[model samples]
Target chain A: MSEAVQLRRRLLLLTPLGVAAAGGVAFLAMLRGMQSGNFDPRGVPSPLVGRRIPDFSLPAQPPDGVGFGSADLLAAGRPVLVNFFASWCVPCVLEAPVLMQLKEAGVPIWGVAYKDQPDAAAQFLRANGDPYARLARDEPGRVAIDFGVYGVPESYFVDRSGIVRWRWAGGLSADTVSQELQPLLRKYA
Target chain B: MRTLLLLLLLAGPAWAVSSPSEMLPDRAQEQRAERIGEQLRCLVCQNQSIEDSEADLARDLRGIVRSRVVAGDSDRQVIAWMQARYGDFVRLDPPFRPLTWLLWSSPVLALAVGAGAVLAGRRRHAAPAPLSDAERARLADLL
Candidate 1:
């Protein structure tokens, strides 16, 4: 056979090999990215993804202080709202007025001051106007950990049985309160 | 009596408690570790934040993060250090740079090319080829 014919045959064999090599590289790149926890298109679901609340205890904030433990959370004979907040958290500030409204409307609300100073928490409540039935200071944030708090200003609607009914992350507005919060509250009621 | 004393001396090391430093992470170090963990990716796990992964490497990385923080590195510095050591593969959200530009853009480019090829194939099949005169004559003969 001529040199050109031989070259053509080699090219035909190499083309598929080149394509296969490129495809393998892409696959390995994706695998490596995922293994490195680097920008995965599909991330892991949290262990607290669909679980109930873990046990928690909180110290009472003074001036109408009540021990707001898990048992107190269930004592209301109604579902309770546990708002994880800190005075420094902006989203918590944003949701404060909405929580006040809920409190005024006879909704059971409690506050867990996550990883905050007791005095600072009290002052925050004084300034924002406390809407919580009980103010519980979580000094080391152990309660917040039990609640799976990734960030502050997260709210959990817990049923009378102490099971978490719904969780709202991020800032809460009137729309969220009306649309999502009320529906869950009604179900518990 | 001498044998009992020798046994007590040997067992003393076993009974000794690990220092708080050796056991639990210090507050400042723990906080730094957590921040670093959220930013880092687990190399052996899929899409898991280094803070959340149970893999052995992840634990080691967490310890490294804490040590770095204790050594007076800022959060940004710690992350930058990881990126330097791991080549941006340790970050869950990598910065958009020339090296990673293809990784980010390749999927959309592939999709666009695939769609174009499919549309072109459909258009070619949709159009009819004109019959030659000999084919028309054959059809006429058949009729």
Candidate 2:
């Protein structure tokens, strides 16, 4: 065969091979994405970020009689951290100490007792060491629904303007508090 | 057999009561809510649509859809509101956008490449050129 014909045949043979290589690359990229947590099953990205906190007014969990409301968030002149917790949730227990530490550091952390009975929620606070500056009862979880809370032990950091700056789902460990919450708090505060 | 029949009849009402009924003010609005709900994915369940999912979030989403439909929001407006609150992941069928271009186009690209390869192979292996008249005559003599 002439050199041109030979080259043409070779190029034709390479076409499918090139496509196969491309397929392999795409497959590898998908695997890498899964490994790097692009679609993390544990958490969904909060759409509340950069938006005003959802409106809610919930009765306070005693011994403090003051209720928690969206107005409180708006009236606050400083940044605030809002935590959603439930007495029935185990992760809430795990994150209680970290919340205490945050309070000790003078972070104005508000608490929402989501879907918990008053007695159970109060007992949980007493047992875990009360860290909330203001605690509210979200008995029907209407407020939690507005906040897009999937489960308990979620936290939101709001800036002075009442916009949610950050949110962390699941439990907060010491490492997460330091690496995630602390930095965001520093920026906003 | 009569006792068993009686028990089944007794249990049937409980089953009917447990199943979700139309919570919207009217049937037409309830249907609109269902159509919208079917398009929205249940964030908690991931795979099931809010209409099909019994998860708490799905129920809440269904309620939101019904309320929006009742409040005179268009279907598109309701969906946009949901997308704003839950991100694009809440939709069962994502809109065609730059980020989803690969997801929407990769299958077409693969099919095109596959068809091209098949056609090229067929052309390369086309039936041997029909025997020339001279060659046929020579083969006849040899036979």
Candidate 3:
């Protein structure tokens, strides 16, 4: 074979290996993103975002009180934050103070206790300092399923029009409040 | 004896992974539920099918599948209901839509690339060009 053909042959032999190396490099970059908290492996983008809120009617947590539903949100004159949390979720404990901060800002926050007993959720709210204006129990988690919630401490921002404008899959950080939530709250307001 | 004991231990966890996701009393309906459950992905345990997952969501999904089957929903309808609520991610078998076209065709692309590389790497091994008259006279003198 001529030198050009031989060189071409060698390069052709290395093409698959080159492709594999590129894939490996891309995979390592993804791992780095995960480590730096820039990417979440568990974050599945909520399909409910950019769409109307799903239909749901859960009972008042601890029984004997009025619980919020989709109609309640649609009737609201402004944006509201819908939070799905559980008493057993550790991240919810960390997030309680941030939620209280939002509550103090006069942001209307609705809480759904996901898959937890009504009594436990009521006690948890009592212990954590209740920041919710209207609280409900998603005892069967059917409401949560409808909302595409896979885990606890998920949140959604619904506009006055009942459109879910934003979704956060994990615990809300201070940055998420100031950066993501605050901007959407203003835009929709 | 040790190998037999090890096999027995392995079988224990294997059986534990899937424990009769059937809730229907009717044998055929229960089997149908089982089949449908296997196609549903557990949102919590993303890798495992609902039938194989013990996650709470998986149990709920299995129950939903069985209820749908019991209510006379076709298998397609049952799967579609889940896909509606949870989006296409709820199904283990991704549908061949625009979003998943690359994922579905990547193997064929890889196969084509591999075949091209293999074909290109083959040596031609063609016969050499004939020697000139000067090279023939030199050969004669050397002989």
Candidate 4:
């Protein structure tokens, strides 16, 4: 073949290989991206972040006999952690101690018992130790939908201005509390 | 008789499961909700759309879609609201955005590259210049 034809043939031969290599690199980058925890499938980012908490008036948990409303979030005059949990959620059971620790540290934690029967939620708190300064019932899960909750054991850190600063889904362990939750709490507080 | 009664009691709540259709107030709204639901991925089920999923979260999403439709939100607005709350992962057919451009286009790109390679190979091996007349004559004589 002529020199130009030979070069054309080589170029054509390498084109697919180059495309494949580029594709492989892209695939690897995606895998690495997922591994870095930016795209965690378990936790979807809430659109409510940096926005005011959705207006809600949920019935308070038993023993308190007082309901929590939107104004309560702002009246605190300090950042508060709102935790969404359910009696049926196993992870919520696991996260109970971490919430208790936050409460012990004087972090005002508001609990939203999502889609749980009042008696069952009360029993759960009785068994696991209530970490909530105030607890509310999210029956029909309307408040959860308003908050854009996907599953149980989710927590949101609302700033003093009633704007949600950070949200974490899934169970909270001691490590996550100290490393992730507390730092944001300190920042907002 | 006692065992049969116990079995009947165990199955008593089986009939209580209600179809999602019952939540909608009208047929048009239900159809609209279903169309939107089919486009939304059920976050709990991961692989199924909200319309096809039996999960509680899917049910809630379906209700939300129906309520939005009834409240006069257009289909596009409802979908946009969901996408905003749930991120791009909530849509089965993800939009062709900067982040998903590769995901949506890579297959077509691969096919084009394959076709190019095959066409180049065919050209490189093109039928031996159609065998010159003299060569054809010789081959016929040899045969």
What DockQ does every candidate get? 0.04, 0.47, 0.45, 0.47
Model 2: share of real contacts kept: 0.50
Write candidate 3's Cα lDDT for B1-143 as tens digits: 99999998877434323464336779898888888888888989899998888888888878888888999999999998888777888888989999999999999999998898677556344455588898899999999
lDDT digits (tens) for residues B13-77 of candidate 2:
43211145536658798787888888998878788888887776677778878888999999999
TM-score of 2: 0.75
The DockQ value obtained for model 3 is: 0.45
Q: B93, model 3: CA deviation in Å?
A: 1.3
Predicted candidate 2 versus true structure: per-residue lDDT over A1-189, tens digit per residue: 459779998988998899899999988987886664454654578889889998778997876688788889889889998999989999899999998998999999899998889899999999998999998888877788778787788899999889998888878888778877788887877
lDDT of each: 0.73, 0.83, 0.85, 0.85
Q: What residue runs in model 1 are displaced by over 4 Å at the alpha carbon?
A: A1-50, B1-143
Q: Give candidate 4 misplaced runs (Cα > 4 Å).
A: A1-38, B1-25, B107-143
**Predicted structure with the largest TM-score when compared to the true one:** 3
Candidate 1 residue A107 Cα shift, in angstroms, is 0.5
What value does the lDDT take at residue A111 in candidate 4? 91
Model 3: pairs clashing at backbone N, Cα or C within 3 Å: none
TM-score of chain A of 1: 0.72
Estimate the TM-score of every prediction.
0.50, 0.75, 0.81, 0.74
Better of 1 and 4 by lDDT: 4
Candidate 1, what DockQ? 0.04
The numbered model that scores best in lDDT is: 3
RMSD of each: 16.7, 5.3, 5.9, 6.6
